[model samples]
Target chain A: MKTTQHKIPTARPSGQRPSGAVVKPVGARPVIGGASSDRVIEFRGVTKLYDGGDIGLDHATFGVEQGEFVFLVGHTGSGKSTIMRLLIKEVQASSGVVNVAGHDLAEIKRKKVPYYRRNIGVVWQDFKLLPNRTVYNNVAYALLVTGHSRKQIREKVPDILRLTGLSTKLHNYPDQLSGGEQQRVSIARAFVNHPPLLLCDEPTGNLDPETSIGIMQLLYRINKTGTTVVVATHDHAMVDKMRRRVIELSAGRIIRDEAAGLYSRDESTREFAVRMRGARLGQPEDS
Target chain B: MRFTFFFREALRSLKRNAMPSFAAMVTVLVTILVLGVFIPIVQATTGAADEIRGKLLIDVYLRTDAKPADVARVRTLLADKTPNVKSVQFVSKEAAYAREKARFPDQYELLGKTNPLPDTFRVTPINPDKISEIRNSLLPVAGGGTVAVDPAIEEVKNRRDQTAKILEATNFIKITMALLASLLALASVLLIANTIRLSLFARRREIEVMKLVGATDSFIRWPFIIEAIIVGGLGALMAISLLAVGKVAILDPFAETFALIAAPETLNFGLLIAILLAAAIGVSAAGSTLSLRRFLRV
Candidate 1:
């Protein structure tokens, strides 16, 4: 008999609780406290200003819990990309602290950046795949950069390609593949290392609606596993269809933070829930 | 494993960027070859000067009327008193006449009738500088018996001194040339390093991508350094080959044309090895240093 240990909420005793409390605390919701395996990214009053004297990020403080999916929605130049760059240590903040996966960004040594980044994966809007390399090599490159052995690379690359729905296009170059397939290859590269955190910056920006929904479903499936996902994009339709926690930014400031919310502002022109459901159904459940 | 990965990458990059690597190699080769030529010339000049000083000898002539006892006394005196006198050979009057006749076969007919020449004692000095010492030691012992030092030995000493001075001037020129060659070689390394750095800069996005995926600094830098080393090594090899061929085909014949200076023979195996090693090491050091600078910075 495999009995699950349910953590009991250790708040004020039921008898000592205040009278007018309408919300019942569900057994602490397994807070997932910083265990050795837990991965959490936190920003404490992080601010970034460009050398040209424009504020890129403004005193943003937030934390993404382990195994959670969150959307970072903002207009152009609204500091969404800035926050992503700070997490990767690609850009330094003007002030305040940034801690990603237990590594402090402020005092992180330059030599450790590669190691720091290895714990996280990144996908770009343009797919950022090497045009010269084949689909198989493109995905394998991530492992290669980490100095993985050839045997591991040979074993892991095919598995990742299969996971990304790119198993059949292994020999094709970026130019030979469709835009969606290229983006899938890029996604495969990001996930090949099995990084705990995956940051996607406008991954579906160039994709058509059908392909965009497919890409979103792929991300959704990946999020279901244990990886924390932070998606920075202006694609309101995809955000609305996912119906996840949305942190909306406006002019370097967080204006809205909604739990299990859909895109409700002016940018919410297209509804993708129906297409997203269809795409989700298209993939085999076991995969 | 790390080094192997980097080396592979470096070889791949070199293949991809063939033109720039080739240019860098040629630049290094030319500089090394020029330096190679100058090194031997400098060594040979110094060697020739030393050889000339060692070979110069002074001869003391005896008067025709001098007694055989006086001649024997002079020989014994030179052997005992002069530290500079390496050896003393007493030339009998008959032997002296025969030597004069050998020098001028046509003049020997007149020499038989006139008896113009005198017997001589050839004093071979341990060094050219000791020629004067031997002359001074013998002058008084001759007792105004017409003791004449061979003018040719004096001429040899003057010529040797002049040759040493000329060699000094040439050595100065060689030093300057060597310095210039070194500077040129350094410039070539810098150019190659900068060119590779610029190429890396252009592919910074690729580097960023690699970095994001956990590429170590060693992994990233190894390829660049290997590429630089390959370029430098190939350049040095080409330069040495050129030097070897030039030394044999060109410099050897030129040396033969002026065989009296002994320049060609002075360029021996030991000197060639020194020049080749210097060039190879110089180019390799320059390339490796430049490449390591960037990696060490991070």
Candidate 2:
């Protein structure tokens, strides 16, 4: 049900170094794909070995290009949220590198974390709406943080609310709205700044089936605006319905990565496992 | 940055974290209360001590047959020997007896016409601290075991026991008062820091939301700063009112009970108000910043 998005905020985790990562040469970044500079999210052998010897992620490497809509479908604890956490700098990679929007996440200083995070919008299973604030103020809060003028915030908040289908509920508090409507306010808040990347962790996990489809459609429409959207979900039916690029994870490793694939692939194709490393040039070679 | 937004959010935050806010406010109330009371007491104590020091005197009784020239020479001698003696006055035998008779009329009546009291020299020191040195210089010193005496002097009394007791008591009062004020102020700071931590803990959810929304550290800090001010200011204002009520009700009614030996100069009412207002804003700002820097991380 509701999973990974709830996990990302147990942040600043104690991560021991994963035992078996190849140390790269100094001044040389491991370019997973030869032309990987344009990728909005890049992970090169990233691992997160949490405290108490539990591995959250292990030696995962992949890249998501600009304007791409991707889904990270995994059961709970399959490291779906770990990848998102790495991108958002919520947790440091125990080994290897995670680069988002052309900046190595670990290199961002502690004080500057707020500035770095503002450029990326993040929503989770919990609507995480300020219950006391009205929907308009909640959405306007995102724009306010980035130093938008009151008038500029006035212009932008309503537009984002309309896009999220929350224009009529602007003055309604979170408790006054339905589950899906509350989620929409959070999404509007996340996207109000038009961040370069939008991350959603089980955005529709708590909603009913029909409401979920509507929320998915809102995210689909937002992705059309050239903002890269990454959704981490355990909802097999929704993943199968969308049929977008899916990164499948099981037990902290990327087991299969498929372009426009269903939630699960046949076990018989195990030997033809899709390679995640050098994509965007062509299709699968099974190597 | 909107005022209405600030007020609205501040009210909600105060409600959400009521315990911590109350604890912080109570701590502020008590701190300002200590400040309001401590300064005046300390000032009053120091003033009383100064008054007591000014009244201390040394008495040197002279040989009754000693000439006025001998008394004058003795005065010059004391002035030269001890830089501490501020002034010296001679009381003639008749005058000494008259003053004594005024104090103990029954004893003087029994003695009839025979005046047994000696002519005396009363010496005042520049300060209480110099009483012993000036007294010693007025009499003869012993080089050997033999106690040599000044020829013009009959007996010398410096009121050494009385002087020692008063100096010790006043000094003790001043030192204890200073120590207590300092310790209370220090305790207040520590209490403020601790209560702020509790307040920040209750604020964790808001902080997490702000951080996720990509608020600048200052932006995230703004709402908390506002809450602390509102709460801390309320506490301080209540303390001021309590003090005003206390001045009229307790201190005024029982003025004699708490009266010092001498109620010396004290903290003016206007100064106390100014200090309390400044402390309210300043301490709340500091308390929030101190706790927020550590506990505000998402």
* Candidate 1 colliding pairs: none
Per residue, candidate 1 scores C-alpha lDDT tens digits across B1-298 of 8677778877877776677667666766665676676656655665665565555566656556777776777677668877787887777778777777888999677656667656666667776554666666544336655333422121112244664565466556556656765686566556555655655555566655666666776676667667766776777777777777876787667665775335545667555756565555555545555645553432
lDDT of 1 by residue, A1-287 (tens): 11111221222112222321111221212234421234377665667999999888876655576777788999999989998888888889998667777667878888888878878889889888876568998888788877689999999999988877888899998999998998899889999898889999999899897787767767766776778888999988777667666777777766655454233322221233344454556543333
B23-107: candidate 2 lDDT, tens digit per residue:
8888889888877777777777877777787789888787778888877777777666666888888788899899899999999
DockQ of each: 0.38, 0.45
Off by over 4 Å in 2: A1-35, A261-287, B1-158, B167-195, B253-262
Task: Write one digit per residue (lDDT tens) for candidate 2, span A73-115.
Answer: 9999999988888887878899977888778888899789889
Q: Candidate 1: which stretches are off by over 4 Å?
A: A1-39, A262-273, A277-287, B1-3, B30-175, B260-298
True contacts kept of each: 0.70, 0.68
